[model samples]
Target chain A: MAFDAFQKRKERQLLWLLLPALVPLLILTIYPALYAVYLSMTNEALTGVAAAKPRFVGAANYLRLFSDGRFWNSLFVTFVFVVGSAIIGQFVLGFISAMALRRKIVGAPVFGAAILLPNAAPEVVAGFMWISMLAGGDHATLSKILVFFGLPYVDWLQTFPLFMVVMVNTWRGIGTAMILLTAGLAAVPAEVYEAARMDGANPRQMFMRITLPLMAPTIFLYMLISTVSTISVFGLVYALTRGGPGNKTEVISVYIYNQSFAAFQIGYGAAGAVVALVVSLALGIAYVRSLKVEV
Target chain B: MAGISEKRSGAYTLLAYVTLIVISIFCVLPFVWMALASIDSNVQLFLKWPDSVTFDHYTKVFAEENGVRWFANSLFTVLSATFIVMVVAGLGGYALSRSKAWWKQPFLYAILLIRVLPSTALLVPLYKILLTANNGIGTVLRPLVGEHYRFVMQLFGFIDGYLGLIIVLATGQLPLALWIMKVFFDGVPKDYEEAAILDGATLVQRIRRVLIPLALPGLAAAGLFAFMSAWGDFLLPLILLSSPELQTLPIGLFRAFLRVNEIDYGLLAALATIYLIPAVIAFSFARRFLVQTFSGGVKG
Candidate 1:
C-alpha cells in the first residue's frame, strides 16, 4: 500500500516537471500554428498597428490567391528555384565533388572546407555580397572582368532574376549538401571499393555500381532537406532585390511578407502562408515516408 | 600489369584534381570577390583588381560610432541564447529519451511542426506578441527574469537590451536543438541508464555521466548549429530591435546596404565579409561533426 502511494506521488512529480517545458511549446509553437490556420480563413489587415479587426471570410482568401497572376508566378518560380538549386545544384555538385575527391587528392580536406565557406557565412551577408558582385554598374567587378574577356555583361537581376537567385542560393547551400554527401560517402566501407577495383572496375563503374547504390538513402535525405531549404529561400531574395527588379524574384515567403506587412493584406498573406504550409506539408510527409521506407 | 595499373591510377588522380580544383574555384569565387570588393574604393570596384586596392571601406565600417555597439549586441544575444538552448535542450532531450511521459510523442511532434513551419506564418503573430509585451506586461516578466538571476538588463548598462533578444532567439532555436539532442541521446541504449539506475545512481548522475559524455560530439555539432543560426539570423533582430544601438551584424549590414542617397557598396561588402567570418571559421572547424549531424537526423 505504501509503495503504491509512493509510485503515484512519483508520477505526479514527473508531470509537474514536464509542465514547464510543455507550457512554452504550447504558447509559442502550437498556439501559433493553430492561430496561423485561423488567420488564413479571416479577412484581417494584419499590420499590427492597424485598427482593423479580423473578420470571418471562409475560404475567400484562398480562392483569390488561386486566381492571382503574381501568385502563380511566385509558385512557378519557387518550383524552379528548388529544382535549380537544391535538386540540381546541391545534389549534382555534391555527388560529383564527393566522387572526385573520394581518394587522396592533394589538399582535398582544405578544398572541402573552402567549399563550405559560403554556407557558413551569414545568409543575409551572402545575399548582399552577391547583389553587389552581380549588380553590374560602374563598380561590378565580375561584369568588368567579363567585359575584359570579351563577354557581354549580362543583367543578372534585371534580365535573369530567377536565375541569379538560383545561383546565389545554390552557392550558399552547397556546403550542407557536400558535408552530408561526404558523410554518406565515408560510410561506404573501403572493402567494397577495393573489391570493385580488383575486378578492374574503373572509377566511373565503381561509382555507378557500388557507390551510387550505397548512397541512395543519403541522396534522398539530402534532396528532401535541400528542397525544403530551397523552398524557404527568402533572406537572399529579401535582401538582394527585395523581390524586385519588378517582382521578378518574388518568392512565396516574400509575397506573404509583403502582403501581411507591406500591403496590410493580412488575410491574403495568411492564405499564402497556408499554401506554403500545404506545399511544405506534402513535401515533408513524402520525405518522412521515404526515410521510413528506406529504414 | 603493375605498370598499366600505376599509369591508370595516375591518370585517374589527375582527373580528380582537375575536377576538384574547378569546383573549389567555383565555390570560393563569390567569397573572394566579396573580400576584394570590401577593400576596393567605389571607383576601383568597376576597375580591374590590380588597380582596385584600398582599405577605406573597412575603416569606414569600423569607424562608424554604432558599429561596436551592434557587434556587442549581436555577440551577447547569440551567446546567451545559445547557452539557454543548450541547457534547456540538453535536459529536455534527456528526459524525452529516458521517460515515456504522457505528452512525449505529442510534444515531440508539435516541436517538429514548429521546426518545419515557415517562419512567415509566425512573424506577424510574434510581432504582435512582442508589441503587446513591450506595451502591456513587460514589467511582469522583468521581475521573474531578475529573480532567476539573468541580471542582464542591469549588466549590459543599456535599457531594452540583450535579455529580450536572447529569449526570442533561444525560443526560436529550441525545437531544432531539442530534436538534435533527443536524437543524440536516443542513440545511447537504455541499458546504460538501467545499469546506473540499478547501481542506485540518481537521474542527474546518469545524465551527467553516461548520457552527456556519450553525446558530446552530437552536442557540439548541435551547439555549433545553434550558434551559427543565431549569429547569422537577420529578420528577428531587424524586427525586434527598433533601436539602432541593438542591431546585429546581419541587420547592420542590411541597413547599410539599403541606405538611400549614395549606397555604400564598398562599406556594405566589407561589413558583410566581417559578418561572414565567424560562421565560416566555426562551420569549417566543425565540418565533419556537421556531416554526422545530418546523417543522424536522416536516420532518426
Candidate 2:
C-alpha cells in the first residue's frame, strides 16, 4: 500500500516534469498538424475571399496536386536530390573518409577538421559561399580554375542546377555521414579483424564478409536520417537557386514554399506538405523496421 | 611475396594520404575563396590576387545596411529559444529518465513521431494559427488597453515579431533536446539523487543541486544545437517575420544580394563571411560535445 502511494506520487511528479516540453509541442506541433489537414481541404489563400471564408473543397487540393506536372516534377527533383546527395554522394565520400581516418594516415586531423568545417556555416551562408564559387562567367571561382586548366568557363548553376545543389549538399552533409559511419566502425570488434587476418583473409574478403554485415544497421540508420533530412532541405537549396533556372531544381520543400508564399495558394501548399510528410513517415517506418530486423 | 606485399601496402598508404589531402583542399578551398573575395572590391574579385585588400565592404555592410540590427535580432532570438529549449528539455528529460511510468514509452514515441515529421509540414498551419491568435489577442487587448491598444496589438501580433519566431524555433528544437537530455539523465548514476532523497531534499532541490551539474555537458550540447538550429534557420524567419528591420542575418544577406540589379560578388561574400563567424565560433567551442552527443545518439 505504501509502495503504491509512492509510485502514485512519482507519476504525478513525472506528469509535471513532462508538462513544459509537452505544452509547446501540443500547441505548436500537434495543433498545427491537425490544422494542416483542415487547411489542405479548403481553398485557402493569403488574399481574396478564400482567405476569409475558405470554404471546404474536400479532396480538390489533392486532386489538383495529383494532376499537377510541377508537383510531379518537384517529387522527381526531391527523389534525385535525396538519392544523389544522401545515398550516393555523401554516403560514398563519407564512408571513404571514415575508412581513411581509421587507417590513421598522415595529416588525418587536418583532413578531419577540413571535412567538418563546412558544417559550421549556416546552410544559407554555405549556399551564398558556394554561389561566389559556382557563379557564372570567367570571373567566378570555378571558371577561373577552369581557365587555368585551358577549359571553357561553364556557368555551373545555370547549366546544372540540380547537380550543383546535390554537390553542395553532399559537401555540407559529408561530415555528418562520416561521424555516424565512424561510430559504426568503432563498434565493430578488433578481434574479428584479427581473426580474419589469422585465417589469411584478404582485406576485400574481410570487409565484404564482416564489416558489411555488422555495419548494416548503422548504414540504414544514416540513410533513414540523411534521406529524410535531405528531403526537408530547403534553406541551402533555396538560398542557392531558389528552385530556379526554371523549376528545374524545385524540390518538394521549395515547391511547397513557392505555392504557399509566392503563389499565395495555402491550400495547395499544404497538400504538398502533407504528401512530403507522409513520404518521410513511410521512410522512417521502413528504416525502423529494418533496424528491428537487424537487431 | 612478403616484400612485394609490404611494398604494395606502402603504395596504398601513399595513395590514401594523397586522397585525404586532395579531399581536404576540395573542402577548404571554397572558404579560402570566400575570404579572398570578401576582402577584395567588385573589380578585384576576378584578379588572381588583389593589388590591395580592403575592409570597405565590411564597413559598408554595417554602416550603410542595418547589419548590426540583423545580427542583434538573430542573437536575441537564438539565445532566447535555446534558453527555453534547455530548461523545458532538462526538466522533462529528468522526469522521463527517472520515472518508471507506464506511459513513458508512448510519450517518447509520440515525441519521436513529431520530430520526424518535416517542419515544413507545420509551417503553413502555424502561419495561419499565428495570424489568427494575433488577431484574437489584438481584439481582446483593444477593449482592455483603450487608446494604447495599438501598442498592445503589436506585442500580440507575433507573425512579424520576435516572440513568435522564438516559440516556433523552440517548438521545433524541443524534441531533439528532450531526447538527448533524457539519454544523458539516464546515464547519470542514481546514487547522488538517492542520497539527496535520504537527506530530505525536495524534488526541486535534488534537481538543482544534484541532477543539473552532472548533466552540464549534455545541457551544453543540447543548448548549442538549439542555438545553431535557430541561428541557421531561414524558412521560419522568412515566413514569420515580415518587417525589414526585424529580418535576421540570413534574410538580410539574401535581400542584400537581391537588392542590387547586378550582384556585387565582393559585398555579398563579405556579408556571408560575417554571417558565418558566430556559427563557426560556436561550432568550434562545442564541437567535442556535439560529436560525443551524435556518437552517443547512434549507440543508443
Candidate 3:
C-alpha cells in the first residue's frame, strides 16, 4: 500500500492548496445563496421594526412578489432587455460585423478594436456617454448627426426608453458577440465553402446549408452565456434610468436593488433574488453540461 | 480559402467595407464625445469639435474633487484582489489539474455554476454576512484599539473596510481564475515536476522552483482578467462601502453625475476617462486571450 499512501498524501497536499480559494467562495457565494433562499421566507428589513424583530413568514414574500405588478413589470423588462440586446440586436449586428470582418477587408483590426472599445468601458462611463448621445436636445450628439442628415432631433432615451436601453446594451455587447461569432466562423472550415462553391452554391446557400448548421453549437453556447449575463445586468440599467420614465426599463437586477436598498424591503428583494438565482442556475447547469459533452 | 472572396461580387465587397465603416463609427462615437469633452475648454453634452483644448478638467478632478482618494482606493483594492486571485488560483489550479480526488470534478463544476449566480442575487445575503463579520471585528477591536478604532476598522472591518472589499472582490473573481489555471496546468508537461522530484526537491521546493516558474503565463492571464473584471465592477463597491473616503472610481463618478442641475460634463468625462484608461489597457493585453478563454479556458 506504499503507492496508495503516496497517492493519499498527494491528494491531501493538493486539497490543502485549494483551501484558500475554497474557504472564501464557500463563505461568500455558496453560503449567501442558500441564505437568500432562507431570507426570502422572512420579513427582513434594513430599518424599522422588521430590522430588529425579523420573523419568518413562509411564502408570504413570494406570494406578494407574484402578485406585484411592478415585480411582473421588472421581469417583463428583463425579458425584453435580454432578447432585444443580447439575442436580436447584438446577434444580428455582431453576425454582420463578424461576416464582414471575415472578408479580409481593409482596416479589419481597426474596426474590431473600435467595436470592442465600448466593451472596455465601465458601465457608469458607458451610461454617461450614452446619456449625452441620447439627451433631449437639438444639439445632442445623436440628434446633431440626425439633424445633419435632415432628420429632426428627439430625445432618444425618453422617446423610446426601453429601445434606447436595448440599443446601448447592444452597442456595448456587439463586440463580445462579434468576437464569439468570429471564433465560430473560423471553426467552419474554408474547404466546406470551397466544395459548396464547386457545387454551384451561392453565398446564401453556403451560409444556410453549411455555415448555420455548423455554427449551431457555438451559437447556442454564446446565446446561453450572453443570456445569463444579461439577466444579471444592473449597472447599465441603473446608470441610464434608475428604472425611470415609469417602470419602462426596470430589469430584474435593478428591481431587486430598488426593492432591497431603496424600498428597504430586504425579504422581498430576497424573493426576487432567489427567482433570478434559480433561473441562472438552471441555465448554468445546461451550459456546464454542454461544455462537458462538447469540449 | 480565397474561393469565397472570388465568388463575392465587387459590389458585395464594397458593401462589406461600408458595413464595417458604419458599424465602427457607431461603436466609436460615444467614446469620441467622452474623450473630446474631457479636454475641451467649454464642454457640451453633445459631440462637437473642441473650440480649445485644456487639461483643467483633469487637474480639477484631482484638486477640487476626491478623485485622488477614489482612484487610489480603487487601484489599491483591485490590484490587491488581482494579486490574491493570481496566487490562490495558481495553487488551486495546479491542484485541480493534478488531483485525482473525488472532489475535483465537483469543485470544477461548482466554480462554473458559481459564475452563473448573478451578483445582484447574492448581494442581499452577502450584505448580511458582511454585517455579521463587521460586528465581530468591531467587538474584537473596539476595546483594543480605543481611539484608533475608526482608522483600524477602516482597514479590517468587513462592511466598509479595505480588507473586506479586497477579499470579496478576490473571491468574486476566483472561479474564473481557478478555471483558467486548472486548464493551464493541465496543458503543462509533468516531466519538469517529475524531474524536480527525482532531484530530491521537497514539495515546497518543487513548487517554488518548478510550478511558479511554469505558472507565470497562466497567472498573468488570471491576474489581468481579475483586474479587468474587478476594475469594471460597480455593485460591489456601491453596496459594501458607504463612506465617502472609501468610494471607488465608479461610485465616485456615479455620485458626481447625480448632481443634476450643475452636472459638469467636462469633469465627469475626465474622471470617467481616467477610470477607463487602465481597464482599456488591461483589456488590450487580454484581447488575444479572449478566444482561448471563451473556447474553453486556454485549451488548445
Candidate 4:
C-alpha cells in the first residue's frame, strides 16, 4: 500500500479540480433535495410564510396522495403515456429503423439523421404541428381523408385528448429512441448475425433469440430514461390541451404547477412534488439495479 | 458484395429507402407546416392556405411586439448559463477523471441525486432562499461591495431576471455536462498525459496543450447539449421569471400557443416553427455527437 508521490499528488489535484463543480452541485441540487424533504413534512400553504409554528404531519402527504383520485388518474395517464410513447411507439419504431439501417440499406446515414428531427424540434412547436394536423384543415383534411377511407373525423382533443397527447409525445420521442437504438444496433457484431443466418435462422427468429437478448440492456436503459422523461410530460400536454376541455389531460407535473403557482397551495403542491420524486427515485433504483446486473 | 446483391437486395433496398423516406417526411412535416403558416397572412392562417403566402405575423413579431427582445433575452441568458456550465463541468470532469479522490463516489452519487430530483420540488425552497437574501447576510455583503453590486449582482436581482434564469438553468445542466466530460476524459488514455508530465509539463500545461485538443469533439457535444437543454427549457424560466420580456423560446411559444380563447392554429404553427429553427440547426450539426453520448453513457 506504499503509494508514490505522483499518486498522492494526483489525488490532491483531482480533489482540487472537483471542488468548483461540487459547490453548485451542493447549493442547487443537494440543498433543494433536502429542502423538498423538509417541505413535504409541513402544513405550510402557498400564500403565506413557511410556518414558524407549523405542525409536522408525518406521512400525511403520502397518505393523502394515495386517497386522491387525481393523483391515481395522473399516475395511470403517466404510465400509459410512457408506454405508448417511449416503449411501444418510439422504442419499436426506433428499433425497426435501426434494424433496417443496420442491414446497410442505401441512404441509412441520411435517414438516421432525419429520424432525429422530431426529437430535435422544440416541444412547443411539436404541439402546434400536431394540433394543426389533428385539427385538420377547416374544409377538413382529416374529415375528407377519413371519409375517403370510410372512417370518422374524430375530435382529437375533445374525445381523445389523452390519446392525442400520447401520440404527440411518441412522435417527439421516437427520434431520440431511434438514435440510441441505432447506436445499439451498430454495436452488435455483424459476425453474430452472419453466423445466425448461416444456421438457417430467419430474420425474425434471429431478432427474437439473438438481437433482442443482446439489446436488452439498451432497451432497459431506454425504458428507464423514457419513463422518467414521460412522467414529467408537461410542455406537450400544456401546449396542446392546457389540461383540457375537462381535466382529461392533466398529468401530475401540470397539476403540481397549477396547485403551486396558479392555485398557490404551496405545501400541498410540495407534497405532490415529493410524490413525483419518490416514484421516479423508485424507478431510478430499479434501473440502477438492472444496470448493475447487466454489467 | 454490391454487384451480387444488386438485384436481390435491390428490391429490399428500395423498400427500406421508401419506408425511411416516408418516416423522414412525417418527422419533418411539422416544420414544413410551421414555415408555411408563419408567413401566411391572418386570413390565410385561420381560414386556409391561398395560392400565395404573406409575412405579416413575422413582421408583427419583429416590429410591433416584445418578441425580438424576448428572443434576445433568452439567447443572452441561456448562452451565459451554457458558458458558465461548460467551464464548471469541464474543470470538474477533468478532476473526476484524473483523481482517485476520497469523495469521488459520493460526489458522483450527489450529482446523480441532483440529476434525478424533479425541478418542481426545488421551486418552493429556491423561492424562499431568494426572497430572504437581501434581508440578512446579503445586506452585509451589499455594503462591502457597494450598492451597485446589490442592484446588479444580488440574488434578488437574479430571482426574476435573466441572471436568475442563467444560474438555475446552468445548475440544472451542470451534472450532465460534468458526467459527459468525465466520460470523455476517462476515454482519453492517461499515457499521453503521463508522457507530458514526465517531460516536465505543469498540470495546467498538460490540460491546455494535451487534453483539450483531444477532447474537442466531446466538448462540442457537451456544449450543444447544454445549450439545447437551456434553450428549450420551460419549467425553470416559468417558475423563476415573471417578466414578460424575460421569457425564453419555450415559454414564449407556449404562451402564444396557449392563448385558448383565440385558438389560432396558423399563428401558433408559425411561432412554433420559428422557435424550432435553432434546435433543428443545432441538433443537425450535433446529431452524431448526441447519438454517441447517449449510446456510450447508456451502454455503460
Which of the numbered candidates is closest to the native, going by highest TM-score?
Answer: 3
Whole-model lDDT per candidate: 0.73, 0.83, 0.91, 0.72
lDDT of 2 by residue, B1-300 (tens): 789768867876777777777777778878887788788754344434554788987888888789889888889888999999999999998888887887787777666667667777788998888888778777787789999865554445678877788888898888878878888888899999889989999999988999889989888888988887778888899888877767889999888877657677777778888889888888777666655555323211
* Candidate 1 lDDT by residue in tens digits, B20-73: 788788778777777777776643444335346798877887796356777777
DockQ of each: 0.50, 0.58, 0.68, 0.52
Each candidate's interface RMSD (Å, one decimal) is 3.1, 3.0, 2.6, 3.3
Error of 4 at A8 (Å): 3.4
Which TM-score does chain B of candidate 3 obtain?
A: 0.96
Give Cα distance to truth, residue B160, candidate 1, Å. 8.0
lDDT accuracy of residue A219 in candidate 3: 88
Backbone clashes in model 3, listed as residue pairs: none
DockQ comparison, 1 vs 3, better candidate: 3
Q: Given candidate 3, what's the lDDT at residue B140?
A: 95
Q: Any runs in candidate 2 off by more than 4 Å, and if so which?
A: A289-295, B42-47, B143-156, B291-300
Residue by residue across B1-300, what tens digits does model 4's lDDT show? 447546756666677777788778767665565677776665332224544677767766667556787678778888898888888888888887777666776666556545656666677777766556524545566777785664454234556656667777888888778878887888899899889988999989987999879878777878888888777777777777776756676787777765668766555555566677777788777776766555324211
Q: Write out the backbone clash pairs for model 2.
A: none
In model 1, state the lDDT of residue A287.
Answer: 65
lDDT of 1 by residue, A1-295 (tens): 9978855665554455445456666666566666777877887784553336667889988899999999998888888888998899877887777777777788887778777777787779778767767776634756777888888787667878888888888787776777788788989999998998888898778878998999898888888877765776677779878888777888888888888888988677878887887777677666655655211
